[model samples]
Target: MIRGMAHHVGIYTRQSEQRASKSEASTETQWDDCVSGLPHWGLEPQHIERYEDLGISAFKDVDRPDYRRLLADAGAGRINVIVVHYMSRFSRRTAQETYDDLSPLLRNGVRLISVGEGREFHANNLFALFELLFKLQASHEESLNKSLAVRAAKDLEARLGGYTGKAPFGFTLVRETRRTDSGKPVSVKILTPDTEHEAPIVRRIAELADNWITENDPTGSVWKIARTLEKEGHKTRGQRMAKARGDARWDDKTVKRVLADPRIAGFDVESVYGTRKDGTRSTTVAEYRLVRRADGSPVQRYTPIIPAEQWYWIQGWLSDRHPGGNPHWDGKPSGLLSAMKLLFCECGATMTHGGSGFKKHYRCRRRAIKPGQHEGEVTIGAKGIEQHLARRIFAVMRAADDESALAVLAEAANRYAVQRERTVALEVTQERDRLLSERARLRRSREAHHADRERVMLKGGFVDDFARESWGETEQALAERMRSIDARIAEIGDSKAVGLPYEVWLTADTDPTGPGSWWDSADFQTKRAFFRLFFDRVSVSKARRWAGRGFPVETRVTIEWAGGVDLSDRPMVGVA
Candidate 1:
């Protein structure tokens, strides 16, 4: 009989289970020792309540059902005492956890007994509390050492192309026994493609994406594929796992993530750092890349569905087709000065590119950034602002005898060409490609117009003079653009970034009334570079007059020159 007010005794047992049956010795020993001298401690068999958590560890944070139930019952005053074969059987958590959990139980008139240690713990016993804390701390330290050793073993297995985690979606895990250096048996999992169900689906997904993008409909394919997969009655990994949750459908984001996973390509993943402007890699991981083996090839856990070449190409195309370069392309970007971040709102926010196709604009995205704080938005049409800045740059170069503006542009052009092709800013590269597409479309339009003009002439009818003039203007515009593009190509003397050198086309073509100036012959990239040099920041205010109201670009726009270097003594025209 126990000599206290404690009435009910809760016996808790946990086994840090391995594959073999340790339960008989582990659990029964705890029960036998606790109840062996029961009558001597003033207790009967009817007073004992058993709480056993089999195949579970006493380690911190493990979800042990019986253990929790025991604690719950004790807290509810159903059990006034807790008994364990060893103190470690009760918990291998940190001393803090023991103090936090057991202190409350003891304070609430509960007593704890450890049969193996021959110890009785109560609220008033300070030495017993100290002994319990010391033992719990030792147990925690031992578990910590075991965790480190496990991590080391797993790292070794991964290096040898052994799969360590659960198999990804398109594969099933096959685990086998392997012995460690100390002859301890360990389980290593291997991945093999699940052909009947998941593997074929993975291949089909890649094929559909490939065909859709090749057909020039690149943007919305992922969502379409998700819909297609659902229609075909395929389920996602989560959907398969959650048998009760029928509403768990596949979504575009999930599909995109699945498509991008390294596991699908049969390689382990690792996080890599982004490179700084000075060309050095950062310490923190900026993005994930496939883990490569020592020979510079990606480590293979199984046969790959998408080859590395195809995988890289698709990722690059999608990323470029959209807009993000991780700021890796520091010098190369195509389009209006605003696109390169020279444009700013009066509120000091950088303007983001807006609109689509030829209807482009630079818009202040402050509302998106701060939400309720901004009252309205600022917007400037790409055409007016770009043309205004170009005229100013050309004007300064023409008026200055030293030709300092030309020199500035020449340096920028050369500086951009130094980065390799792999590092070319995606925006500029996309711009050049888009322009080429536009030029081809225009050629087709001109061809169709010529055919219609010939039809009227063949009927022995006069094609109107106004119509003829319209054709001529169209033809002339086409020819001028073609010639300018050719000249720009010839002038770009460095890498594809520059196309040619500064010495090739630094000559002045400043006449305002001329058919075309040097500005006309500058490539989109060169134009962007020139603008970057000319302005540190171009501030814009919300247009008071817009749409049908009209463009007040001249008054609403302000400029801050780069390096505080003014390109002209003449007050800038068409700008505030």
Candidate 2:
């Protein structure tokens, strides 16, 4: 501390190895320089507190923990002087951030000193403050230029079919030896397939994807494939798995990424970068082209996991499964109970499709003693059960043309409206109120600043122009935030009015033939929509019947209608 009022000195230093040269001073050297200079400023060795941020970029206004604590200590009057090796070490962010950080310290009677620059920042030193801001702006521009250069280099490397950054999954980097002009050995890094363990797993995953397409197995979805891999004790390979905090089990996303990667099909892909409205860029695979040698011949970079034909076939299948695709038919219902969630067994396990096409049936998936071993369970044939349920459902729809069904439908619509209000509208209202409150607070702060502008200019330490500019920026930011909040509220309101059941039901009812006919002629998605709209639940139970002296198991289907009607005793025979 220089005087009695200045009792503690905070030393702030930062070094980013990524952004700085190898010859640059480390955090330790910065700390030693600041410590040695503290005594000259009348601050004692015991009063000096060091704050260092290692490997953190100075151009970003991210939450640097020690830097934040240093500010807190200064604001709380625990520290009167802040020391740094240089102003750039303190911050290389935009001029606005530097102003925002140092303004409050100057106002609170704290001094910031830079040992390298041989200067102290105070209210009277306007020239030094401007110089510091100019340096910060220069640093910001330098960072931007460096970023552009790096991106250009990456683009060039990608076009040349060279791997950028880390080698992707299923590939390992190795140095290939080559001779230079002087006949000395040189090494060049190149990617090769990992054959030890990961290559086989990659091949297996590709085979599973191909089988799903060739055999038309909807049950072998991405999620199912991930589960099968986990059951077989397979794990994902990568640095992410090594550093993961939780159980790093294989997931549907991981499996999907591996399957979709073009490199596995022996092609080199170029990444496409798109800039968002916020000025941030995102990279995604643009196209997969065959790798070529210098002689313009195709190069086989790695052994293809799956044939290219099979990979494209799988891609077509995946595209058809997406919403708005050809849903009327893709192939036979991949399973009898493909998307039905209402079917459950007596053992309390949701029934899943078993067996291949035509012979497919729903069976309980619960395990018995061992993990892979399943217990004795009920099974119902797909075609027979669907036929039985369709007839019953058609009868129910015919009966629902009465006044009672209208009343029930009206009640359900009202419940839906109430639920929408509680969930969507309520959230919009709460967020709008919060934003309005913040806007009001900002207005108050602006008014106060205007009322005390003269007093601040005279003794508040900040230059008058900077003070006014910061206040204006703050006002603009608050106004933009409020506009965004308003836009969100309007969007929520519009969404709430769009999806009412009454509107759709009215249109469906006014159709030419009859309600049942319209439902029957509808597409797969429309039929599914009607099913969800009319039925609350469908459960199945096993019943024993004597068929020519042998006891044959039959499945009893129970349908609980959404309009308060319960239909049971619908029997499908010879299923189990």
Candidate 3:
């Protein structure tokens, strides 16, 4: 019989638990918590056998053989051994080994007492089974608790947009700043690091890989690249040489890793976890990092580290090298019809392609020649319209070169300025009342006040209602004065100064014979662009008979630039 127990007992519990504190309540039947003072309950002093009395002078004397021999004697009903707790004195490497070792003692008459647990080892089959179940439950509970804690941590990280798992090369987790803008005072929150820092080495690696691919270097595999990096004094994340294997300085795996890593280019990497053939975990890339704007909007980040124009030239060169002509259009070719796409008819129909003889034209797809319900389709060739319009514009520009046109422009500019000044001078005295009232209302609305209105009025006060009433009369007077001066200037200049291109009037006045040719000198894109910019649409019909005489090969070409004008009753010329 055990006499006095130690003050505190050591109950070896599962890995999940921490040692109980002194303030924790001690239990008599639960061996899960270690406690002592067992003999103090009721045992007599004579019944207690100290370590010396039991032939064990020191704790070390209680070896395995000693315990085994004690168990054998107990099995023969020769002795009983007492323990403060079941786990206190029972020590083995594993539960299975401990159970095997204790089997002999269980087969004997040794009734073991766990004073703390009030348990007696009666060598019963049910008792041994119960112990095994208890240990298994303890292990399962410990695993579940650990899994829950880890899950909670990962969820928190995702919510805060923090990195949760392993760090990618060239990136280190760093704390992000959070601020509170309370009225009383600002506050800051400090938390774990998560953001990746941009590394220049990533860019260097990509540039190197791109160069290798372009040059078609035989020795420039990923392994070679890593070796070169190491030779150049580069280090890994651990800041040491990556141990070289075989004849290669760096392995193939290392080089491939560097080339394929988008993070090397300083982008947030995207990857998915995968399992390898060897049943080991691995990673597969989904996409690379994107360049973002200041507000995190994506935009173009790289130009391939190659010149665009040069790249196109090389592609064409390669195509030609293969004995076939390049089938692609050089996107930068020059064109006169660049603005054609913006041209459309007021009727909201796109111009359709049409040509007569050799001349190409763009005409309204919906137009009909006749006004009544019987009106049929209209058509126009592109060449006829371009030539006619170009001639008319050339005429107007040339006419403007004369002294008479300049005189007219100068006279208009001067007269308008004088009229504008006089109107302001006469109205200033009464203009301030309304202006001030408007300003006050604008201020009350908390709207920003601008000085543009006041500045313009101060420079030239606006015309009042009374002045406005007579403004038309004053404008007419100014025009007559300018016209009279212009006519005098015209007398000194040639008649061509006032008349538009002599050809323009001829086209407007006389009818021509057949469709014209224009597309010979222009490509498809140029012709299309011209049609879009020069004319809204053209409407044409085969010569019609009115009163039994055929109307002069009549057509209408609608101009788009400088405000549209329609040239009607025009002739279409047939190309030889």
Candidate 4:
């Protein structure tokens, strides 16, 4: 029954070689073995016998171009294309490649069969097209879904109060598992690397820094200390080559990187990369610009493998010798006032420090006297203005009626919520309309292409022109849909909706000086929340003093509340 009717069937795939007592196998080999002796659904025993005569050869590690060429030559005369699996076994990972390779074979009477899936030579043209589209869509969706899940997981992990990337150099990841009573699953813990051995080296480095400064080198730096350590045969952690930079040996930079490493102190760090408004990527520094822990005290900050006292000693000694005397202390205004460059000025001009010597003040950044502009120039000295304004505002708010003020805030919040809901509804409607239009356009293009193809084949019309027109129409539809989606997102406006504005009016009747300072007397969390809500900036301005005389500016003054009157226009006296 062996014959030459079927010439050859080439199986090409990528598979690793396995070493086993029963059999040495590749994926293709395993698949072939499974299908070889099995009865074909349509192929008679004689056809199987002829297949053996034609010869079955499996080609491993074959690339896509080689496989396509082989398939093309085989389809011209004798042979069929049967893949083990559709996507995993045979994929170029490009939609165009799939279309080009498969379309030609299909048109030239070549057949495709997935032996593993038991899908033989499917004869129905429409069914085959649908199957191919379904598979392609599934593959596309799988890749996109995987990408989104990974991004979301990475973001969540970053926010989980720990390191989001590689475990610090000192640590190693180890898999752990355990069993409970009755052999059930138990708990797991990631063991931190032991730093007991490394802690001594850190202390030594700090001590060296302190010693170098005390020796009065004046220009003594971290580099001098590192070189001194290297000469003393002090090796780095783990018998590994000492961390070096160029010919200088392990320097301060190396020591610093190691000492500042959070892993050594049993803490974690997470750095996030994000895109800026200018369409560029940026990496944020450590979170918590300045941390104050729950205990209302400054954080017990991470150490740089150096004892606190030694580091302090080194810093103190360096400061004493350095000429500039801590360059940061230049008597310039800093903190909340320094950061508020945009808020104070109406014409968007930055103010300057004006006071003589260390007693600084802020002056108006104006362009002389401008036409139609009234106010001559409001000059507010730094400390007096800041403290007076803060105390006055706090006193006013504390004296206000709590229930009435909160009711106003609640109404404003409700209005904002309603507006946001309407915006969301509008976006959904617009998106649905866009999708419906795209679907219609796609359907029309498909129908037109089918009709045009028929005309070219049956009526002997210009094939090139018809084909070009059909492709153009399809491309147009695709472009339109893409544009619509992009436009829809834009119409949705900014991603994060601004929260509603809630106002609280502060009165002068029940002032803090009247009974108790409301701010100091309020609950801790309430005080914190209030500060976060209304107050954007708080600058402790210096009190005005001149020629050894303190002006009696009505210290602890009381406000006369004119019973829900508009006293905003009235002249107000100063408070202590």
| Per-candidate local distance difference test | 0.66, 0.62, 0.40, 0.44
Clashes of each: 11, 1, 14, 4
* lDDT tens digits by residue: candidate 1, 1-576: 343565788998777763233355477666887888555556653477999997688885657899889888888888887888888888888999877877788898787888778788888988888888899999888888998898998897765446776666688776777766788766777677777677787777777777755655434346777888999988776676654354688776666666776667776676557656777765544544555444233455567777544454455344334232233534233446544556788777878776877888887877554643446767788887887766665555444355555555544443333223324455554555566566677678778878887888898887688978988998888778877765554454222434333333345444432346556776775566556655667788777756778566666777665434444444633232
**Candidate 1 Cα errors over 4 Å, as ranges:** 1-91, 100-121, 126-131, 138-142, 176-187, 242-247, 271-287, 293-301, 321-360, 364-371, 379-576
| lDDT of predicted model 1 | 0.66
Best by lDDT: 1
lDDT of 1 at 190: 69
After superposing candidate 4 on the true structure, give the runs of residues whose Cα lies further than 4 Å from its correct spot.
1-132, 140-165, 168-264, 267-354, 357-359, 362-380, 388-576
Alpha carbon lDDT at 40, candidate 1: 53
Model 2 has a clash total of 1
**TM, every model:** 0.45, 0.41, 0.27, 0.29
Better structure of 1 and 2 per lDDT: 1
Which window of 10 residues has the lowest lDDT sum in candidate 1? 413-422
lDDT of 3 by residue, 373-451 (tens): 2334444445554555444333333344554334433333332222222223223312433443444554543222225
Whole-structure CA lDDT of model 3: 0.40
Clashing residue pairs, backbone N/CA/C < 3 A, model 2 = 1-43
- Please state the error at residue 464 of candidate 4 in Å: 99
What pairs collide in candidate 4?
383-541, 383-542, 396-506, 397-506
